[model samples]
Target: MASSSKCAFLVFLCVIVLLAPSEVHAKSMAKAQGGWYLVEGLCSKFPDCNKHCKEQGFLGGQCLKLGVNMLCFCIHT
Candidate 1:
């Protein structure tokens, strides 16, 4: 019974971890008044995306892995 409880707890924790990122992403998207911008160049790091977006007069940006591509999405208010 204890082992089963531990397994259930692990499953619940895994689900939370997986869903947390999406929830945060959705909230960020909602705050993007100027919408998302597809930044050109390789997004090897998150800070690189942020720097590019700031140069373009945006609030900030994030590096997202989309299938075969690592795309940069800039957000602005």
Candidate 2:
């Protein structure tokens, strides 16, 4: 009766707790692919840059420029 209902409720709560970690991991993956979400969400309140720093042509000089731009943009406004 009442005791069984309480047990069932406890089991439901335990199931929800078990599922919570998966939900958190999924959200983290989503954020990683979507953008620099956590940093922007916490700090200067925007995603840092759209440019990719690891591209091939960027090694010569372009990445340096992009990096500078990103730093300036992130720091100033």
Candidate 3:
């Protein structure tokens, strides 16, 4: 029983270590791609970000046409 518990713990630690890099990379990518910052029930788009959406350009102008609530929350500067 003790051996099995140890093995399980070791496996869990190994999984965490292996997955950590990908998780960090994903977070960095999201930051790099820009993200919605929540502030007082308002979501603000990162306009001065290093990355921009090539399809719609910026969230302030055309992406506003998607849905009223979502556009309001996500498109605010």
Pick by lDDT: 2 or 3, better one: 3
TM-score per model over all chains: 0.43, 0.34, 0.34
| lDDT of each residue in 1-77, candidate 3, tens digit only | 99999999999999998765433311111121255521112113424232333223434322222222222222223
Q: Rank the candidates by lDDT, best first.
A: 1, 3, 2
TM-score of 3: 0.34
Whole-structure CA lDDT of model 1: 0.65
List ranges where model 2 is wrong by over 4 Å.
Answer: 25-77
Model 1, range 1-77, lDDT digits (tens) per residue?
Answer: 99999999999999998766433433233333446554443466455888888887887777777555566778765
lDDT of each: 0.65, 0.32, 0.36
Give the lDDT of residue 66 in candidate 1: 57
Clashing pairs in 2: none
- CA deviation > 4 Å runs, candidate 3: 25-77
RMSD (Cα, Å) for all candidates, in order, is 8.6, 13.0, 11.7
Task: Report, for all candidates in order, the number of backbone clashes.
Answer: 0, 0, 0
Best by lDDT: 1
lDDT of 2 by residue, 1-77 (tens): 99999999999999998766433312111123324321112112223232322222221111112221322111111
